[model samples]
Target: MTFASWQFAVFAAIVFGVYYLPPVRPFQVQLLVAASLFFYGYGQPELLPLLGIAVGGTYLFLVLALRDRRWLPVGIIFNLALLAFFKYKFLFFDPQAPALVDIAAIDFLLKLPLPIGISFFVFHNISLLVDLTRDKKAPLPSPTDVFLYIIFFPQLVAGPITRAGLFLPQIEPKRFSDVQLVEAAKWILIGFFFKLYVANNLNEMTSHMDFPFYETLQTQDRWLLVILYGYQIYADFFGYSAIAIGLGLLFGYRLPINFDLPYISASFSEFWTRWHISLSTWLRTYLYIPLGGNRCGKFRTYLNLIIVMGLGGLWHGVGPSYLIWGVMHGLLLAVERPFLKKFEGIKSAGFRALRIAAVFFCVTMLWIFFKLPNFDHALAYLAGMFRPSTNPNPTKLYYDLALLYSLPVILQHLHLNSFFERRLAAWEPYVYGALAALAYLEAGPATAFIYFQF
Candidate 1:
């Protein structure tokens, strides 16, 4: 279930109450783990074994950490195997492949429903193992701590991808701080505005311009969708992140900030440093650096960056589109590497704003690669935007263009960076109270978060 939905709000309220009660203190972690499992299973009950088996086995492996750290590799491999089986195996070969006729379990494996947050869970667990191995100073969290770490519902679906090292230590149920409570309220309100007002507006517009209708739009109508789409996804995702972080604060936990006005970055490297900071960092730490980071020669570093990002792209889905998206970002990162010096001097308000707009548009253009099913569809949509046809189109909502343009510049600029920090610094309880109310009123249909599908 979506955390932004009424059902999830109800779930969180129940969990929150039970979590803080003194009598339930000792078992709170177990309660959370159970809730996590229940939450994951609520929509797709059939995927229980697929998620449970791995989670349980990983728990066991970690419990045996002192005796056999060696088991970590085996455990990760086993989890990856499960992930491959359920998420990636069928995606490897197209349905039309001649080799498909020889398979027996192909139908079962291919058609199996994916468990929500499989990638997040598996990767977080890997981080746990890596921490245990690399930073021996790190203490292994209690079973309950570990359980809560994996199960925290906010980031569970589409995540800022919380880390055990960061979250497990905050396992105890503490009294709510007035300041944190207030910050949570601000987050809830701001996030609500973005999700409901900004993102939804763009989404409605884009829904009209989908494949069928998209091919027939006039140039002006076509560009309108691209701009709207860009705003829609940005608002949708970043709005979710803000709310998640806010909710974390209400529970007295601090989540790492996710967005940093990435569109404002003057260069591509700056964009990577700012956008989806969590995933980028995760990939760098776990995948790139280990594979031979910049310590190698320049060319090797670039290769590693491409490889890391390429796989990172594939991590999003089992399609060439995602591969292209990943590669495109990688290439952008590569080319922009040497141009940072040129961009560093862009400081005037007018120039900075223009740079942000340009970058935002560029990023939005790439987002087509992320949102569309394939390159052909993306090209068609792009084509439609530039060349109008008399053919039919989806319910295009050009009326929302003015609102969408103001989104990134006005609403989005509200939380550039250190937003969480600034709220915490303010430390007012009323903020969180306001947030709780907003979350209550802005309830969605309880759709699973977009990232959860990954």
Candidate 2:
């Protein structure tokens, strides 16, 4: 069920009603688990077994993690293998072709449907196993709680990717605090507003624009589109996280937050720290740390960073674009490390602002690759971004609203980036009000989240 649709609103209301009834605590937990299964299986009922297998397989992996430290490596390998089969079926099948025609044949023959948000789910499950490895003495939970946490519908698609250790333990009985409920309601509403009004509307700006026209537009306009895209995605996705975290709270679960005003960061490292905190934390703890992290030599540290970030990039999609994206960040991180010390004492305000602008521009450009379907398409889009203007049919309302819409991010960047960097907490009221209004607004047709297909 899409969080943007009335289906989800009604779903949330029913869940909330049951959750508030004092006698429904334990049953509500089980009901949520069942609802989650229905959510995942509702569309693709044929593949319900895949979820069951994942749950059973993960449970088994955790069991092994407790047996021997070596099993941690083995279990992870198994999880990766499973992920590869479903997520990388196209990649795996590529070599089976004798001709380009054979590629079509293979895709047809495989009949594999990529599980919705399989990437997010795999990472979350992997994190659970890593947490087990970290605390050798951590007691195993009832499989039900772990199941509930992992399969919860809200974060199942695009995620905050809450660590099982963070959420699973919090499922105990407690009265719903009024403040928490109100806060939860606010987040849910904010998520709806972002996904619907801001992100959804901004998406409409470019949806109808022909590629030929977009390619010929002035640099300023193309750049505006790109910036708008970045904002739309952040609002849509981070908003989803807010709703998910809020819903988790409604049930007495405190999920870790996903975003922290990422645009405010002056550096890529800082940006990752703020954006998708849960995924970054997962990569840092499970992938980076396990790969020896910075504990090894400087060169190895750089290599490890690249490897993790590259995998992190690939984790978003099973494509060459994603691979290059990961490698690009890896290279950027390596270059930034050497330059970090020198830039530390550069106290010139103008210079700092310029540096931030350059980085933001660069980052926004890179997002073009992520947005595009393929590498060649991205190249064409880049050409459009820089090319001579043909018809400069600027989207005035889009431009106006986009700039106005991103004011919060702008303020946060100023405060957090200083002279521009604003503390993330200051937007609390806006977040609440936006979400509440979203909940009250009539939900139009359901539109799937971009990441859900991953």
Q: Give the top-scoring candidate (TM-score).
A: 2
Residue 80, candidate 2: Cα error in Å is 1.1
The window of 10 residues in a row where model 1 has the poorest summed lDDT is 439-448
Give candidate 2's TM-score.
Answer: 0.87
What is the number of backbone collisions in each predicted candidate, taken in the order shown? 12, 12
TM-score, candidate 1, is 0.85
User: Cα lDDT for residue 10, model 2?
Assistant: 90
Model 1 lDDT at residue 431: 49
Cα TM-score per model: 0.85, 0.87
* Candidate models: Cα lDDT each: 0.71, 0.73
